[model samples]
Target chain A: MTAVMETAGLGKQYGKRWALHDCSLAIPEGKVVGLVGPNGAGKTTLLQLAAGLLTPTAGTIEVLGGHPGSGPEQLGRVGFVAQDTPAYSRMSVSQHLRMGALLNSHWDDELAFRRIEALDIDPRQRAGSLSGGQRAQLALTLAIAKRPEVLLLDEPVASLDPLARREFLQVLMEVVAEHGVSVVLSSHLVADLERVCDYLVVLVASHIQVADDVAELLATHHRISGPRRDSRSLPADQHVIEESHTDRQTTLLIRTEQPILDPAWTTRPVTLEDIVLAYMGQARDQERARKSGLGVLR
Target chain B: MMRFAWLQFRNQAAVVFGGLAVVAVILAITGPHLVHLYDTTVATCAAHGNCSTATSVFLKNDHTLQILFDALVVVVPGIIGVFWGAPLVARELESGTFRLVWTQSVTRTRWIVLKLGVVGLASIVAAGLLGLMVTWWSSPMDRANASMYTAFDQRDLVPLGYAAFAFVLGVLCGVLIRRTLPAMGTTLVAFVATRLLVNHFVLPKLIAPTQRSFALNGVTVQGFGQMNGGPFTLFPANPNIPNAWFYSTQFVDRAGHPLSTQVLTSACPLLESGPGPSAPAGGGVESAVPAPGAGSALHDCIAKLAATYHEVVAFQPASRYWSFQWCELAIYLGVAVVLAGTCIWWVRRRLS
Candidate 1:
């Protein structure tokens, strides 16, 4: 399958700090790709790089086999909903739709009106008066009505209440199912992505910890608990992502292709959140080690 | 893209144009009466030999309106820059709506170009209409004052160019600053600074001034004086050219060298007097009239001075008013175009 978005060693820096660094990923077409990370983990930076809101400081990025925001055709093919879902505050809902129609070559007027009507948002109401959920939905309608091949959303539901978040996800899933457009949305909450995302990319500390099909990741990663032991003794094939030990018990989140043959350990299936958190913890430890190692060198 | 630009610009345009319309109606109502007053008084005052009184009366007819209109022409372009141009791009960036519009089926270059073109054109048109209306309504007063250069900045063609330059400068500031209020403030300061710089420094050198020499006769010599026992000096009256921009008037010898005090004292012993009656304490001319009984001595001294030295005056003639206006317009428009190109480049390459 063709990759909807691809980056090779992509990096972005602001002044002395690197927002995203040494990132490489090829997101397959037609998948709900969840870019999950902790706060300040460069999730927004990577998404913005793909959406052409920002340029990479190192390496290169391509969306749908074209440079992001390179030309009219490239711009038309990709849709971007920024973090705040900003719309012209003074402009009414209908004016926002008019703007979409006027600015996009392939604007789906019927779809735009249908979404607004179904959402029960008043066409004459200004965007600034709308609730947070309504604003996000309006922003989504604008993005999707342009009929883009790929949609990139940066923390669209980060500010919404749980119910609003659920409704947003439901609408998003319906749009994805109906249009089959590739989606890449960033969120700090893994639960937000759990219901809709089929592809997962775990980013931590300005780097990609893991990226893979959700089912494959679940199949390969297992949480095993047993009597206290050193993680260094684990077989090389079973990579320990995260490890915890008490006086008499040890638990490890491991990624391995083979089943655990040791009967001493109790192995249980892991949720998506478990997999993400394990990767996050592993990345954090590595970062801490690198920092303290530099301190020693200094 | 044009439609979208207009859609965004229409409200600001409405407010500005509506204000202009109200001003236009007021001018239309009072304009003909002012013109009629000028025709009856100042125009025919020459035959009655009461031109001074008639001209003053005509100028004083709409004193408050004159100040208001003149101030309007000067301030409108800066207003356009601050309210229209600065916020045009900065608001989008500040509100994060650029992400929505820029990602549509339009290149950033096209987006900026269209926005600038649409709004810039409207600003220019507004300034032009304002210039035309004010120039028409204020014609009587301008003629009565007979000092065209005094009101140069608040008059025709130049304001249009100023509006263009101010608009583009604001856009450049907005693009670089990326915030609305700060950009507006910066644009205002920048626009005012540029106008002051151009007005004070750039304008005088635009065209070489015309030089004319007048013999140092009694009529040409406004006054003469010696200050605190210093060398004697002569003051030449302004050249008799109406509505001219005078650069300077110098007392020069036949060889084009400045006439020295040593030569003056030697040629006329009467100059040894403390100061001429017309000379103020600091050597300025208080009156053209010579002291009582010293008139003949003054004439003799002037005659002696005229034989060797003459008064050289440099000024821009009234006939060159249109030329200066056009030159200023071209300069402002040229700079505006360069600034606009810079804005486009910055938006495309540097903004992200």
Candidate 2:
């Protein structure tokens, strides 16, 4: 399968601080890939670099088989909905549609108008007066109607009410299914991503903790609790993702492609949320260690 | 891109041209009358004899219009810079809407170019038309004076350059500052400062000024008056070159050596140069030679002592009026191009 978005040692620096660095990964096309991270995990920086809203300070990023923002042709291939889902406040809903048609090479006007009509948006209403949810819907419509090869969204539902968020994801899923567009969406809340995401990328502290298919991740990762024991005693193939212990008891979430043969430990399948949080905790530890001028915890 | 650019500036264009139309109507209606009045009173009277009264009346005809139009010519470019240019990018950046537009099929280069292209062209047209109106209305008065300095910045084709420069300069500031209020303030400060610096320091050096050397002995001496002891030069406007831009007027020894202050101040009568304490407050020019015969006695004494001295002047010729206008226009436009290019580079390379 062809990769829709790929980064090799990608990094971005704002003023002397590197927001993201040493990132390398490839996201396969035709999948809804969720990017989960903490507040300053460089999620926005990563999405912006892929969308060409920002240029990398180091390394390279490619989207749709070309450099991001190489030119208009490259720009046309990717769509982005920035953090706040901004729209021109003075323009009418129809004016935005007109802008999309004028600025995009392959605009899908029928899809845009139909979506607007079904959402109950008044065509003549100025965007400034639209409610928050309506504005997000409008912004999403504009991005979706562009018929991009890859769509990158930065915290697309970060501010919406629960109902609005659900509606946004619903519309998004419908569009993706119809268009077969690859998507990479970022959010701090894994639950928001869990419902719709088929693949997952967990990022923390400017580092990619894990990138894997959600189903594969669920099948291989397990949280096992049993009598206290040294983590080194686990099978060589079962890599320890996270470890916690109390007196006379041991709990560990380990990833193993092999089946668990030891009957002494009860293995429970991992949820996407649990897997992401475990990586996030590890990233936090890595950050603290680096800040104190120490080596990586592993 | 042109269509989108026009859409963004649609309201500003309407407001600007709407204001221009109103001013155009007012100027058209009143302009001819002012020209006729100048011709009838000042021109005719000056031909036969001294026309001080005629001149005064001409200067008084449209006092309010003069103030309004003069202020407009000076302030209009700066207003466009602040209202239109500063807010162009700053508002988008501040509200985070650039993320929406910059991500589109249009490259940042085309986005900035089209905006500057549409609005920049409009700025030139608006300022040009306004310049035409003001220049035409002020032509009669302008012709009556030999020196162009009186209304230089407030008339002619230079406003087009000024408006265009200010607009781009404001845009550059907005691109760098990325905030509406700071960009506006910086643009105003920068525009006004550049205008003043060019007018005072750069204009003289732009083209070499002509030096006019002549003897001071032959001219009529307006009698000097004593006021508290320190001396000063009191002379009428030179009639030989009435319209010259005088850079300096100095007293020099016959061999062209500048006279030392001690000797000059000690020998010559100390004069109350301009409506000073000892002179009649509103006595005007006549006060310099209070009684008729009082002039010759002072003139003869100064002429005999001044035999050792002569006066020299440095000036710009009056014929350079249009040349100066065009020269300044090219300079402003040249600087404007550099500024605009920098803005485009910044948006493409450094904006995010």
Residues B141-249 of candidate 2 have per-residue lDDT tens digits of: 6666545667878888899999999999999999999999999999999999999999999888888878655665535233344324434433422436756777776
**DockQ for model 1?**
0.84
Model 2 / residue B279 / CA error / Å: 7.4
Whole-model lDDT values for every prediction: 0.91, 0.84
Q: Candidate 1: which stretches are off by over 4 Å?
A: B225-232, B265-276, B280-291
TM-score (0 to 1) for chain B of model 1: 0.92
User: What lDDT is reached at residue A189 by model 2?
Assistant: 100
Whole-structure CA lDDT of model 1: 0.91
DockQ of each: 0.84, 0.82
lDDT of 1 by residue, B1-352 (tens): 9998999889999999999999999999999999999898999998999899888877888899989999999999999999988998899999989888888889999999999999999999999899889999998888888889998988888999999999999998899999999999999999999999998899999899999998888667866764455566776788678899999988998889998878877887775563344453343334334577556666778887787899999999999999999999999999999999999999888877
Predicted structure 1, TM vs. truth:
0.95
For TM-score, the strongest prediction is 1
Chain A TM-score per model, please list them: 0.98, 0.96
Clashing pairs in model 2?
A: none
Candidate 2 CAPRI category: high
